[model samples]
Target: MIKRVHVLEDDEDIRYIIGVLLKDEGYELQLSSSFSDLKSKLKDSVPDLFILDVMIPDGNGTDICADLKNDIFTKQIPIIVMSADDKNKDKSLGAGADDYISKPFDIDHIVNRINKLLVK
Candidate 1:
């Protein structure tokens, strides 16, 4: 089955880049630029993995990550958080993110991390 990935990022360029890269890897990509959009997308179906940006226009990804982890239905989904703040990696991880990727991240590394998480 093709794995589905949900990307929650407010930056258009970054969001587009991620979508293209993951699509190239044969994974279905779902993109959301705001909290409301993310919620609506989730209502439709949960993705195999989530790539969340720490700072979004509507809300913080860390808080969203926490909410997802605490929810019984969504808790099993793996999350990979991206942030420009390197220090937030620990915070995101503490919030139950499966992995943290800093901004200006290597695309190859991101793909590898996603692959590793999906394998688990």
Candidate 2:
């Protein structure tokens, strides 16, 4: 099955980069800039995975992660919380994120993590 991944990242360049990377890797992509956009998009379709930024424009990514994890519909979807701040790693995990990747991250690392989680 072709897996779909929803990404909430405020930086246009980073979002574009990830979209291109995932699309090339044969995963379906849904990109959103804010929590509201993510919520609206999810009403139509739920993704197999979520890549969220810790600092988003409309909401804290950790908070969003917690919300998703608490919901029965989205709880099983793997969530990777990323941030430029390495300090938020614990917070991300505390919020029920499956993984945490700090910014300046290697593209391969993210892709590898996605592959690993999707396997389970």
Candidate 3:
């Protein structure tokens, strides 16, 4: 099955880069640059995985992750927290993110992590 990935990131450059990197990997991507946009996108469909940036303009991804994890419908979906704040790893994990990736991330490593999470 082609895994669907929803990326909630406010950084335009990083978001574009991630989208490009995953485009050829056969995963369906739903990219949102804002909290409202992400919510709107989720209203229509839920992706198999969620890749979130910890710091966003309107809200933090950790909170979003927590909300999703608490939701019966979205609880099973794996979440990957990508952030520039390395200190937030523990917090993100505590918030129910399945994986954490620090900023200035290596594309190959991110891909490997995503693959591993998808397999689980």
Best by lDDT: 2
- The digit string of per-residue lDDT tens for model 3 on 32-117 reads 99889988998899999999999999999999999999999899999999889899999999999999999999999998898898
Q: Give a tens-digit lDDT track for model 1, residues 1-120.
A: 999999999999999999999999989999999989999988999999999999999999999999999999889999999999998999999999999999998999999999999983
Better of 1 and 2 by lDDT: 2
Give Cα distance to truth, residue 110, candidate 1, Å. 0.5
Each prediction's TM-score versus the true structure = 0.98, 0.98, 0.96
Q: What TM-score, to 2 decimals, does candidate 2 have?
A: 0.98
Roughly what TM-score does model 1 have, to 2 decimal places? Answer: 0.98
The lDDT ranking, best first, is: 2, 1, 3
Better of 1 and 3 by TM-score: 1
Clash statistics: count for each candidate: 0, 0, 0
lDDT of model 2 at position 56: 90
